[model samples]
Target: MKNNFSHFLASLIAVPVGLIFWVLSSNIFDIHLFLDVLVGIGGFGASYLPTQQIFHKKHLDKYKLTNSEYKYIKEQLNQADEQIKRLRSSYMNIRTIKDAKMIYEINRIIKTIISSVEEEPRKFYRGQQFFHSNLESAVNTIEKYLYLYKMPGKSKQERMQLHETRLSLLELKRTLQSNLSHMNASSYDDLDVERELIKRNADRSKKRQALLTNKLDKEKINLKKDQAKEYVYRGDKNGE
Candidate 1:
């Protein structure tokens, strides 16, 4: 919202700056009105485009997103936001605390996935199931469950359906968790690789240090032996 507002404010400033430029150019140079209008539009664009670029560049830098990635992620976010709203509506119809908590947990997981995807757009691809199908399915299932739950009287079959729906929701929650784990699997892999590298380097360093220590110890032993021989020779020569 703040970023959008900045663009809007920049546009407002640009309009006036453009008009001023147009007026100045026309009066000073006595240019044609068509040229003046063109200059005005150009001025507006020049002013607004830079501001937009600056804001967009900052946004891209913050998320490390390419323009295409940002646009795709934004589209996905919009769709997710609409689905989440529907999901929340189902929450309002929930009757039991247990069911409410379940819905809350699902919502929490979906939001966490969204937040992760927002920070790293590449995760959207990894979490396509949650972002694309599972989320919408969750909304539909919850709403259907709640609708059946609030019926005047549930038949044995309807109650059984409800039971299955509940189970399905639980399974869906687990699936969402799996999706999140999938999204972060690469990060975990990277961490594991780094840990292995560090361990190898540390072991190598320790070996090098140990070898150096052993060499120094051998040198010291040899030096001591040489010193003792020299002392014996000096004492024997002095006695002679």
Candidate 2:
């Protein structure tokens, strides 16, 4: 964010600097109008290029991913995005709420899978079934199923084909669910470990707190006893 702000600031500064250059060239140096404009552009470029390069370098390095890996992941994500669009488009062909609910569930799974892969690019490897096959298959199956279901006066054979395609869509949904589970299994394991550690730390903290409270109570009792002894001695001296 800071880098982006700096880039914006640089751009804002460049525009004015460019104008200044143009004004100085035309008025003070008596340069030609075209040359003045060129000088202004050169000034803008000079002011903008350094910050632009710096911002890009920092932004790219922030991910700690190599350029090639980043590029490949970006390309794959773009393809996944297109597949998702096709899937959503297929949803419009759904006439029944029952099948619509299935598509919705499948959509949720696909989004979660993509989001997980996006957050941890390495998980993209785990979702090869989704990005490479299952998602595309689902889209194709949904389209084919709807196309058949919409046919006029479908004969028995056509109805059976529609039924089979519906089955294929259900199977695709299950496969997508499996793909999502596979992709997130490692993350779930990590979460389990983290939760265990947090629980252990919390238990230790509770024990320490209990011990400290006990110590404080003991000190309070001891202080009360000492005060009683002092009062008794003073009373005995006064009596003497």
lDDT of each: 0.86, 0.82
Error of 1 at 16 (Å): 15
The RMSD (Cα, Å) of candidate 1 is 5.3
* Residue-level lDDT tens digits of model 2 in 32-97: 999999999999999888867776666657756666776787788888889888877776677788
Best by lDDT: 1
What's the lDDT for residue 224 in model 2? 99
For residue 153, model 2's alpha carbon misses the true position, in angstroms, by 2.3
Superposed by TM-score, candidate 1 places the C-alpha of residue 213 at a distance from the truth, in angstroms, of 1.3
Q: Which ten residues in a row have the lowest lDDT in candidate 2?
A: 1-10
lDDT of 2 at 80: 82
RMSD of each: 5.3, 3.5
